[model samples]
Target chain A: MEQGIQIVSILIAGVIFYGGVGWLLDRWLGTMFWTPCGIIVGTALGVYWVVKKYGQAR
Target chain B: MGGFLIPLEGEWVSPGVHSFDSRPLFPGVLPDWVNGHLAQAVIGAALVIGFWLWVSRRQQIVPTKRQFVGEWLYDFVRNNISREALGPDYRKYHPYLLALFSFILVNNLFGEFFVFMFPTFSKIGYAYGLAVASWVLYNAAGIKRDGFGHYMKKMTLPEGVPIYMAWLIIPLEFLSNFIVRPFTLALRLFANLFAGHLVILVFVLGGTYLLTLKDNLFYNFSGGVSILFSFAIFALEIFIGALQAYIFTVLTAQYVHSSISEEH
Candidate 1:
């Protein structure tokens, strides 16, 4: 069940990050290519959150 | 071999000529000599280039029927990406930029999306290669346009910032403008493709898993749901694939435009 949930979350994250970022990049930069950049930024944000929480746990 | 109704399991191996671990990347090795990913990418590329060459064999003022289709696609990217992103000087850059758009569009659409089970763009290396190409092109163009010193200055220091804030803003600006942009450029494509492939994998595999569960009705229901979702995502993948390729190409052009324009 945990794995199932994780898969769901990842899929959700993938869709949101890909679609949202692509939309934002197109709007902000006037190009759809920036969408990929948004994904990278979102992933960085996710990584930062993980790192910060893991640090707090330690 | 068993009858057609029964399913079979096989070991995993990498997709192409490149061996992941001497086994087939996805069950049922395609024989050692056959290069899967490379063949697909190369053949896909060849087809696009060949089709254009075949269509445009003779130049025309008004364009023949076959040439019209090519012209329309070229014009679409030219207007949407080149002229739209870079503004005035886009005409000068249209040919190469058009090639980039078409190559990526075709590769992503046909090579990746049309494959049904496997999208070629899902490969991380392909995305990285594109990123590196983009990074090199923009940086080189910047340095070429305004010398190294001017280029660095434009990247590192902003025009309107107060003097005292230089200590703070300069480093942050440099990091965001120079360092993070290209890094994310590659990662953006890589992560999207990677994650997209994984989602499709999960649903497809889940469907298979449920189907294998001893003729249970619930399993059939879930399997049906998975198939429907998989097809839906597959359609969405077509849009995502083309959109990502377009965005990447245009952004590269935008970076070049910003760099050469000499204004903030």
Candidate 2:
């Protein structure tokens, strides 16, 4: 349960942080679709981080 | 069971977030700071302190029942939680871990107790306060052990990430470590206690309301059943209360361990 919570939190943190940045960049660049792309990228990165940090046998 | 669906004269509104409000125990006699939840916190602290004091005052080689229980709790926190999570250097943090566990356990159990029916952490502020304290402790420990520059690098920079990927990893690491850790810590505890108490309230209050329905045999019977089930919920709440305390303490220890460890 604790590991699950940590994973979900990391995913959420990734999406929020990167997605917010994407949204701002979209506004600056006069585009409208960067947010979702950012979220997807963020999620992949987040999962990689989790796998590296916690998924291995310690 | 279909007959139990008795139409009510008024809406049977379920208890909502407002149910967690901390009303003054005494309407006007005490100061405003003395509210139900605050009083419960004070009582919880007093209970923890008093219990430890009583146990520590009498050091028995052959322990009595009370002393045995007290020692068991201390050992559980010190050995099972702090030592397991913090590794070989766990002794320095045993006191904080034990205090945190005991204090949280008492406050969480307050909801189950007859006198104080509110868990203090349901207030959110208290949970955040504890989380911030843990946050500060871990970060300070890391910085103290490794200089501030080294600690920042260790925390925000991954061990094996390529230099090209540092842009993404750094921000994510920063947010995960510095921002999300404390936020999730506080929200996890506050949400669990708040939702747990709200569930009990729904059952108990709804059961009472159903029982009070006029001339409805099925509603009354179902209400009794609801109230009976609430006792089971109360048992689950107690388990969750203790489980959350352990989780919070262990996670804190893990965070501290991660902070002061040689590698991330």
Best by lDDT: 2
The residue-level lDDT of candidate 1 at B18 comes to 39
**In model 2, what lDDT does residue B144 have?**
98
Kindly report the root-mean-square deviation of model 1 from the true structure over all alpha carbons: 13.1
Tell me the lDDT of candidate 2.
0.87
Over the stretch B1-264, how does candidate 2's per-residue lDDT look in tens digits? 345554533578789988877788787788877887787788898999998998887778999988898889888888889888887899998898899999999999998988888889989999999999999999999999999999999988868878888888888888888899999889999999999999999999899778767799999899989999999999999999999999899889888988999885
* Candidate 1 per-residue lDDT over residues B1-264, each given as its tens digit: 235424523332223323121223344545553446656667767877888798778979988899898778877888888888778887766766776666667666652344534455567676677777777777787898899999989876647656875564454445555655565666666666666666666677667666555658897788778978888877777788788787777777777676777664
For model 1, what is the C-alpha lDDT against the true structure?
A: 0.64
Alpha carbon lDDT at B74, candidate 2: 89
| Local distance difference test scores for all models | 0.64, 0.87
For model 1, what share of native contacts is present? 0.00
Clashes per model (N, Cα, C within 3 A): 12, 0
Which portions of model 2 show Cα errors greater than 4 Å?
A1-9, A26-31, A51-58, B1-12, B25-33
